[model samples]
Target: MERKNLVIVGGGSTYTLGIIMSLIEEKENFPLQNLTFYDTDADRQEKIAKATEILLSEHYPELESFSYTTDKAAAFADIDAAFVQIRTGGLAMRELDEQIPLQHGVVGQETCGAGGMAYGLRSIKDMIDLVNDIRYYSRDAWILNYTNPAAIVGLALKREFPDDLRILNICDMPIAIMKSYADLLEKDVWELVPEYFGLNHFGWFSKLLDKAGNDLTDEIKDKIINGDFLPTDKEIANDESWIQTFRQARQMLIDFPEFLPNTYLQYYLYPDDLAKKESPDNTRARQVINGREKRVHEHCDQIIQQGTAKDIDVEADIHGVYMIRAAASLLFNLKETFVVMVENQGVISNLPADALVEVPALLTNHGPKAFSVGEIPVFYKGLIENQHAYERLVVEAYYENSYNKLLQALTLNRTIVSAPKAKAILDDLIEANKDYWPALK
Candidate 1:
């Protein structure tokens, strides 16, 4: 029952409210001594911080202190753990990430194909700087990074901070997927234990077991393959793009029933079909800006205007809850099993030892002890190798500013196999991301 101090790095984000609500909700289990919010944008952070102050006063006033600031040192100082959920260029850049690729008939996903590579390059330097700031302020502080394109970001962090075990790069997509599977099986998500393998947003569940150790993989697979696919989470279900993504996931499972496919695999496996359905003008970024972004900000404005959170529509979802619990596990030495991104080191016997792979690991005070995935079949191996190569080249391209390496990464990507298309996408992305990305030769 030891209380802890926490800081959420991206205080201005739409998702920050959810994390705050989740922290308040879990106060009984993971008590907080102090809570801090840090972001570069003072105006946006002020809005979120004001809403949070109202919510905390109305709900859990037990917190000893609550504050938000743009000062990195003030934010990082005395914090036991930091939840990093930053978007380097925000949604304006995400729109370009998705739109630019679709203009050339390739998948313009948030974390796959050319878009992911673009975002990944932009994210690398920022993440490295954030880590350095955290370490400088609190040498022992734990960093729970939930950044997008985690596959590339994770690899970059590993390379930069090889000996820093405190940084845990993670994504909530797998947990989101497991929630749907749990819903299908009529169980709580916590009761399910998944044995998974491969890269972030590019993995599969080999086995899923209930608390009693009953295998539920085949049952869930059957449900997905038989067109019983739908996200039980209301937030995701409300998004039409997410609904289509679920359907595509079902199609992937139907085509290859050996193991359950991650929903993102669809973007790579069926890029042509997905690309044809997309309107570059009305990309996923626009949907989010028009939908969740608009809704969250309006609710925050309402809470601020009313000076109370009693009737506000905002509430914590799985994304917030999962991150808080992961940090709690780290702080309290709970050793809970979670699927996190970590250096392979032979975890996946067939993949390169240095590759950053996502697998279930025991989250303890010392850091994650990754589970062994052993040798995968040739098909999955080939797919992961190609994706991993693309991820590696993106990281290399960022540091070296080698235009050719980026071209190679895009050409090898499953969503854009044509070298001509890859080159064109690269040039457009370079121009669009000139402000964020390093200049390439």
Candidate 2:
């Protein structure tokens, strides 16, 4: 196997360690010559880097080299690929994103509706910058982007680099759901191929085909409709908050039995339910800040204080292995099928040709070629059309810096439909995200 050099762009993120651990596990298949953690936050990355350094020395002594840096040139130079997982304003800003929306009686959550719209605007500039740097230093390096608000971010990237096939935008939510289905079927997820279509975070799986070409969609639908909402392999399913989120899928199934809805639909389809249940002060961000964020940092601190990675509580981010595997498939031309966001170009017959849609695609060294989604039901198409308009406007707002475009984007959102409500949420988000978001005219 050919070893490669890679960089983790947002290396300071708590998700970094897990990705590193996963790389170590995949050494035989996709070995790395060097792994660099690049982040602007020197102080934060340093803690995680120190822990990682000790982690390497203790276990994979033969692993040649690793380093951490804030230097852009050094970070991008001569890398085979880059894995980006940036959260622009950190969890502090996420607290505001969630809190601000809930204050106005809207769904206060990351990567959905009002909160996601705000976060998307902040992410565009950074992601564009990172991709530009990667292309400059390593023109052919594949960029596996796992950034949030993927619908907007994916659309923005397409606009900035229209022809750069190296950038692949993906979300792991569908992957996690597949894991649950795999567990239910007593088979691995890789053995199952899904027939799905729609915008990121808003899609429906109509079919699940196995390697032998048997259809498992009916079985899965029955299980879901009958209220057997299973546990997923990702971290989200393990949490109490997420468990409640998953349980709501039962109601969604009972309501729309034709297909299994993506978990995020709970926010869009049942807005009243979310608005009533969510806490303005004690939101998801607060839970994460007090739960995983605190624990991850505290564990890093322990590793730092002890000056050793031994007994460090960092778990392998199995959830992240999909990105690396996708990268490997591309670099080696292994031709793996995975769901990714891309310009539709007739992949979904009903949608505009240029819309950024998430569909299963064959990933190779040449980039992704999406499998055809002939067409969707009229009801689903109508819902997606509204979302596409919103996503497009967000990108326009970022590029044009038009205040009206931003307002229109928010108004199109199901969570903030009224022009007045849209303005209320937008103003609060603008005030909260002043430092990160672009100045709208």
Candidate 3:
């Protein structure tokens, strides 16, 4: 078996710890030849790199190499797989993530609405730079991008780096939700085989069936509608009010029989309503930044404080498993269905060919073959059409450096007040993200 050289771009991330742990747990299936960590923040990367080395050395000593570096060229060189989970700007910009969307009366949240758009702007340049580096150094390496504003980032990379065969963008939200549903219904995820379709965060469970061929949509719908489901303890749900909002959305799904709503749709569909509700007393982002993010940072601080610290026990988290599976399927020519973002390519008959759609795809050495998703509900078509336009405009704006396209992306978002309001918010975002974004002056 050929050894896999895995390079994690945002290796210092708390999320990375889980991915490393998962890889270790599944070492028998996917053995890694070497592991490397790269982050712009040397101090932070050093901590995770050290910790990971300690963990891997104690357990999987056969691993060929372990290195952490700030140099982009050195980090990406000869890498077979790259997992990207970078937040272009730190949490200091999170206030902007909230306020900007609220300015447009959009449900202001961290990763889903206008805030995500803002974050996307900041990330595009850096993501492109990283991808370009991989292409330059490791021409055959696959880039598994799990970065935020996933749709925009995926689309941007597809458009800009069309010839690059190595990039695949993924998100854990849908997968995580599906796993929760599976656990609730007492079935393995593989057995539940779902037919899901739509854009990034805004997607639906079109069909869900067990291995025995029993349809479970109605049961799942009932649970969602009646609010009978319990929040996962792993999820930081400190806000009872947010929980109630979820319940309300569930009620809407029940009342409106045609479409099943995703948790994120509430942000766009009822922006003004959710914004007026106070910020959740506890948000996942806050919990993560305060708890895991802080701990990771403190661990780094300790390494710096002591001049050097031994590698601590670390494990690959499951978050990056989807990417690993995709790569394995492609490399070994295994036939497997994985969720991927690609050009509609007629997969969804109703969507435009150019529009990027998230749907199940068959992976093989030849690459991803997007499977067709039969006609979607009319309501979902409308939502996808509206959001697809915004996503395309964002990519156009970034690539062409067009202010008009940028404004169009903002205007298409359901949260914008009007053309004038959209332009105002666009100006603010442009200014706020000036450092990270290309000159849109």
Candidate 4:
């Protein structure tokens, strides 16, 4: 039971409080010698840091030391792991990421199609710098990156940090879906084992098994197709857009019943429908800003005013739980199986060896060892190949600062197949993200 030091990059995020609460709850298993919050925004991090200080004192007072800072050297110093969830330009950029595409009559999701491309490009430079900073201070620290548009960011990190294997890119959508599946089957989430494949936010679950190893894929698919599928988490289900996302997942299954599609696939599979449903005036970013963002900050204020979180409803969210659990698996050598993003390297026999793919892998002390997916069918292979090309082009576009490469990537994207429309959206995105993205040639 060796205690470890941890640093949470982007500690100003709405997720920071929940993650800190999770650390307190799992203090026994994933004991921490120190905890640090590192963020660029001092005001934003201060609220969470002050509230966390009060909560930790009230709950886990035995913790040795805790602090928050903007100093990279102080934050990353002597840390065994880093939970990285940075937003390069924050939610304002995200609002544009969603809105600009819709103005072009295209899907405007945070992590799909043209919007994901925009977000991915913005994330690359920051992620690269963040990783370099972490290595400079804590060379051996495990960097658990759960950044949005993980598909592109994952590939960019792989290309930039080829020899550095300490980085692990992950997304919680699959876990969230599995929680819904478990709820439908009347079982706890951990009791089920799922076999899935493809890129992050663009994957499919080929099989799901109960603890007894009973095949539950078809059963869950049947339920999803027949009934109103929604997230099991009450907090998520409350969001209207999330509800639509789950409902659209049901529609995808009815149309392509071969494998269970990721909820995000709805954005790619039915861009026109999604675009029609999306209101340009009120995008997902707006909803989050008005909803969770407001609530969490207010709640943190209340906790700080009260000087105790004992009365405040402090529940560790799925994202926080997943991150802490995954980090623990790596630190303690738990060998737990979790779906994570890793280099293809023949994991998908038909896909290129260099492509970054998301698959279930065993989390050992060294990092994730991905499971072999063998060769996929022609239909899936075609879709994945196209998507992978789009992802690769985004990375290349960033590195080479080539506008044409980005246009090609957006055109190849399923959401906006027309070259003309892709160019229009790319131009607007370029204007919107000029401050963050590299100057394109």
Task: Itemize residue pairs with steric clashes in candidate 4.
Answer: none
> For residues 112-147, what per-residue lDDT tens digits would candidate 4 score against the true structure?
999999999999999999999999998999999999
TM-score of each: 0.98, 0.96, 0.89, 0.98
Q: Single out the weakest 10-residue window by summed lDDT for candidate 1.
A: 226-235
lDDT on C-alpha atoms for all candidate structures: 0.91, 0.86, 0.73, 0.91
TM-score of 2: 0.96
- Report the C-alpha lDDT of model 2 over 121-219, residue by residue, as the tens digit: 999999998898888899989998989989999999999999998889988888888888887787888899898898899998888999999999888
State the lDDT at 404 in candidate 3: 87
Clashes of 1: 0
lDDT of 1 by residue, 205-255 (tens): 999999899999988987777657977675686787888888888888889
Q: For every model in order, what is the number of clashing pairs?
A: 0, 0, 13, 0
Model 4, runs deviating above 4 Å = none
Clashes of 3: 13
The residue-level lDDT of candidate 2 at 331 comes to: 89
Candidate that beats the other on TM-score, 3 or 4, i.e. the better one: 4
